[model samples]
Target: MSFLLEFVRDPLTVGAITPSGAALARVATAAVPRTGSPVVVELGPGTGAFTEAIQRRLAGRGLHIAVEVNPRFAQHLGALHPGVDVVTADATDLAAVLARRGISQADVVVSGLPWAAFAEHRQRDVLRAVVAALPPHGVFTTFAYLHSRWLPPARRLLTSLRARFDEVVVSRTEWANVPPALVYYCRRPVTEAP
Candidate 1:
């Protein structure tokens, strides 16, 4: 917790106080379908907060790969979440990381990345990697704080997401969360990628 607090000092980077609560976690996990032996990927699992949530959601069904950029946090996550494959890697390099792990596509992708902090190109890059890593019917669930419920960028991002995925859903809003957030759940489009 201390490490997270220290790292998240940058409002844009960290984006919130402590990690999300159980309610939000539940929504994030439930956004994806729990297929038999499915492959799950978590991006930017800071301090293993969301990692723990994802673990409970998987219920030991499939492979859960946690990709974190922070080496210290990665090590901490490895020790904290024993079953998770805690890899120190960038979220934008999902394809390369999956290849090294012999994973072709993911059944679900849950992101705890601070999207508001990322640049436009970075956001596109991250989404591209995530989409490329997902199989047909795969789901991606991500959350952003509701600091400004009427922010223009948030709407723009949602619009962009709709263009790429088929079922773009906004999961339950977590008003009790540290900063009050909303989870966006999306499913892969059936149409072949253009």
Candidate 2:
């Protein structure tokens, strides 16, 4: 109900009408490694759908920082999952956010942002921040709703991803999710001269 309300209030930031389902969450958070103490950064984790799966994968082993733009969502998530370091900030400030925590680079970055709702420049800026926050070996995972995959914004997101990373793998559609979605696992940040 809260999720729907938020979405209705601001579709661009809140994205979906409902929180992501378990199936989509699992697929989106697959990039979080199980063995090491990895610094995982989650972007736009509205209502912590992917946050729960990420915490499960971490199993009390690593730093899980969730950066959400909505203060309401951030506060609720921080209270529900005391384990996560929830920061109320924009995704484009990923580098600065990690820097403040003394994290030089994140091992994995999982995003629940609404790419299809963003303008081209916002999408590029956010993706650049993600790439900048990651080391070469770091992995970045984000999802796109299957129904909106062909939209201009979605296509721009794909183009941005491919340009930033050496390898971008699109996962199979998570049919169980509402409206269905697919995950994009990106690796090897291709840092460019500014």
Tell me the whole-model lDDT of each prediction, alpha carbons only: 0.78, 0.93
Which residue runs does candidate 1 get wrong by more than 4 Å? 1-4, 8-13, 190-194
- lDDT of prediction 1: 0.78
Among these predicted structures, which one has the highest TM-score? 2
| lDDT of each residue in 20-98, candidate 1, tens digit only | 7877777777855455787889998878767877887778888999998877778878988899998898888899999
- Superposed by TM-score, candidate 2 places the C-alpha of residue 123 at a distance from the truth, in angstroms, of 0.2
Off by over 4 Å in 2: none
> 16 in model 1: Cα distance from truth in Å?
2.7
Cα TM-score of candidate 1: 0.89
Worst 10 residues of 1 by lDDT: 6-15
TM-score of each: 0.89, 0.97
Model 2: lDDT of residue 174: 96
lDDT of 2 by residue, 132-182 (tens): 889889999999999999988999888889988999999999999998999
